[model samples]
Target: MSDNYSIARYLISQLRPGLQLGETVLSPDGKVLLYAGTILTEKHIEKLSYYNCEGVRVRELQSGVGMGFDSNQQRKRGNAEPEELIVSHEYYEADMAATVSEQETEFAGIYGNVVKDLKRCFTIVRLEKHLDCELLQSIVDALLTLSERGIGATALLHTATRSEDYLFHHSVNVGILANIIGNLSGAFKPSQQRNLILAGILHDIGKLEIPVHVLYKKGSLDEDELHMVRQHPAIAFKFFRRFKEIPESVRLGVLQHHERDDGSGYPLQTAGAKNHPIAKVLGIADVYDAMTSKKVYGEEVSPFAALDTIQADSFSGKFSPKYSTPFLHELCQTLIGRYVTLNDGSTGQLVFWNRSGKETCLIRFSDGQVIDIMNQNKLKVIKLVC
Candidate 1:
């Protein structure tokens, strides 16, 4: 094993179950094979070997020691093939090593309860083709109350480590995000805000109509499969049309959530003003959660990365600038004073932003060293440490 700060690179033969990755593992084809924070398993090892992967970088123990293997013994293995090293810039999270805060614990509890409720609600909708409006309303109300208490994207990201079902958790998170965007936009009244949250909750309901195998497929989808997947928005729109209790704006948001302002979106290819305001907010919230939430098929990115992507898209006319601007600004302010781990394996507290460049920020490390992470090519903020 070769050590770089708290990271150790291990050959496939040296990998063992329970070892957590410190960076992403990609295939020769440039597709992500395993994400950072993934605990190694026998299956994962087999997959890595099947792909002819060279090595993986794993987290060192909190005591600054390598986990268990002897580096000399690993090097002496005669049959082991030479591994071509690859550089990774992705952030890593070792929740086991970081200290959890009261807010994280609280969010986890709330997330667990809401996910269970959402699962049950989805099951009922699937069997009866009827949404239990009161039950879903209660769930959204609970999420709104939590939103009122003030929770940030970082808290939501860390709390997701305990969740297993991506769909249910994504639904609840989008609801919360939509509500936050609504509150920040100041364009919606109380009733409309509740409806927008409901819209977010039901935004991906059409995905349930898709086959499980297709919905959770490991890699790329064929053109036919992609076509089927894009039909989700239309399916959801038709289903919601049955209920008069749902507002027209809420239904429109569900249908057009995937419809980008630049006409790059699917289904109807609707552009700019053709999309509903609620849909516009839902679109931003949807992408943000999808990028920041841990999933079975993809890795969750840091909030800073997600914000950067959104800002770029907003500038390119894909997302509405009005909502995206304030949302990004608020999220940056929320990240201040929070703990973060950088690509260099150093943990620090985020102090402030330069407010000039998207990636420029100040981080104060444990040794009282404050870094301007501005033009440092190797230094990147990787993950939020609770």
Candidate 2:
């Protein structure tokens, strides 16, 4: 087989039976569903759809005589010529819009289930004052599985609305975000990554111990109440200490997730190397989720704004650059190709993003005008429409 084929991305909804995969498709758990160069069939398409795969990379052949798929067969099957099979911009946009909607709906269902399970587990632990490691681990495992669904899962984080069950939603979002950061950092093994996610999930579990009135108060907290809220990490640490299933690093991470590199954060005021490695990653996730999530106190911040904050913090010594660099890099890739509504009341597709030097984006408008948003300070992304 010739290695000369190019690869193109296509939404699962746009996939046809005669197309050949340019890359292997894997399940959330890393199980291979199909191999590269495999000629797709009705069964293959059905299987891919069954997995809720967002999209696939298909081979664009010079002449589909190699890779076990013949162009002639595709034509005989009443499919379009291989050269004309490329997904058009309009087609991609239409298909992706549908895909994103379906993904968000599916994600909402999964998220609701996990949050319910987490709330139940929290209730059990709070009443019994006992840590059910297995139960909590099961919830965490479900979250990890959801987080492994690729970029769509990440985008789903923003789709979630702030509800009265803020704690549960926040915890789940942080866990998924932490897992993404860990994977992007390339600094953690699989075991360490799991621990990082576990830490994120349980980081705010201590808040459950705080008085409801104090925790949910809409107004500014008094000094005493603020101090009481700050102690949740320590409180959560004490809870995790009873369980041997929770790794020592996870305990530290939960305990010091608020700790900053500059020693400005709560409870311990641990600085730089004094903070556990996992704690640093958790801190970024925690802050990002808090800022991006809609709040009763304030409107949700745009993700581009959140990224800007992370970038600024990375340079300010509050967030470690090691993890923030890769997190921003990977996250920017996901945000690209998304449609956004600008502050100037214009809607366009984000065609280019350059986070280096200066944070800027190139948006291609419907009138085919490309605008560099950085040149127009008043122009900024206000919302992700799809």
Candidate 3:
């Protein structure tokens, strides 16, 4: 392969069958160069003996049987037979011949700044209610600006991570995702969008008062511990009540985010007729984030799976049908064209969105192969690889 070859050009090559190796496979500096060719047998290794290349190595590979180079390694190391051989280049660049380098750079930079601003906003909220309302409003304005420009705010928010401040990051993610859902459903105006964002940012503020051990406990909560957990909504409600100037809509969203439309939620079991519209939106966003986030007890579910679960429950009368159908459909559409990593360690692009079945997507690999997630039983979507 040439240095000028674009990453998109190589995507198809990675899907090719047999042992195909590049000279600069996985190199950091991106200066390594090598040829790509198939390995017929161990005897064929001698053919390259005349080509003196330093740091040369041979590895067995299989195609269509698994996902990427990493998947091949795992299968091969686990007593699986070698079905192909792949050569790699000496160096692999991070950007790897991207078509729109400038655009990518700008997008990454903006995303980074947004994450930073979200963290700052949470910190101010934690310290006191003295945060500059205008500053908080400005952050919301910035997000809307990027969203209007066609950036997937939900995906961008999903990609950001925080190790030490899990609550803050989680809250921001919930807000961004809720705002995206509201915008997609055509239910929110500019003012409502800002309110939703603010509500999302503060939805779990009550959790701050809980003991860290209880919040981060690895095992299931006992009855007494669960009692404490249930008090968070009330704690949040009381805290917000102290701020009389805060909009009632924002406060109500924080208090009622956990309330279900079927009257099964905690504190107040408000049914569809009783639950506020903002609260319903917040509830959907809250559970979606929780189920998709890594926790002590279990790994996060795939975004597609989470959406499926919500849709299933909605149809069964567990959630409000008014908001659930459109929200799930829009979310699935937003995820089309994104790349994801499967539970089996395969990397592919999500090319289709199907809302009717357990398998909801068509994931295409580099080798002109497509995995019908709706039909494949062995593989399931695990997460969106940002």
Can you give the TM-score per candidate against the true fold? 0.72, 0.74, 0.70
Candidate 1 lDDT, 15-111, residue by residue in tens: 8864656665667754455545454557668989999988888767656653322223222111223331111222223333333445446667876
lDDT (0-100) at residue 324 of candidate 1?
81
Best by TM-score: 2
Question: How are the candidates ranked when ordered by lDDT, highest leading?
Answer: 2, 1, 3
* Candidate 3, position 29, lDDT: 33
User: In model 2, which regions exceed 4 Å deviation?
Assistant: 1-96, 101-106, 150-152
Worst window of 10 by summed lDDT in candidate 2: 69-78
Candidate 2 TM-score, C-alpha based? 0.74
Between candidates 2 and 3, which one is better according to TM-score? 2
Give the winner by lDDT.
Answer: 2
Whole-model Cα lDDT of every candidate shown, in order: 0.73, 0.74, 0.59
Clashes of each: 0, 0, 22
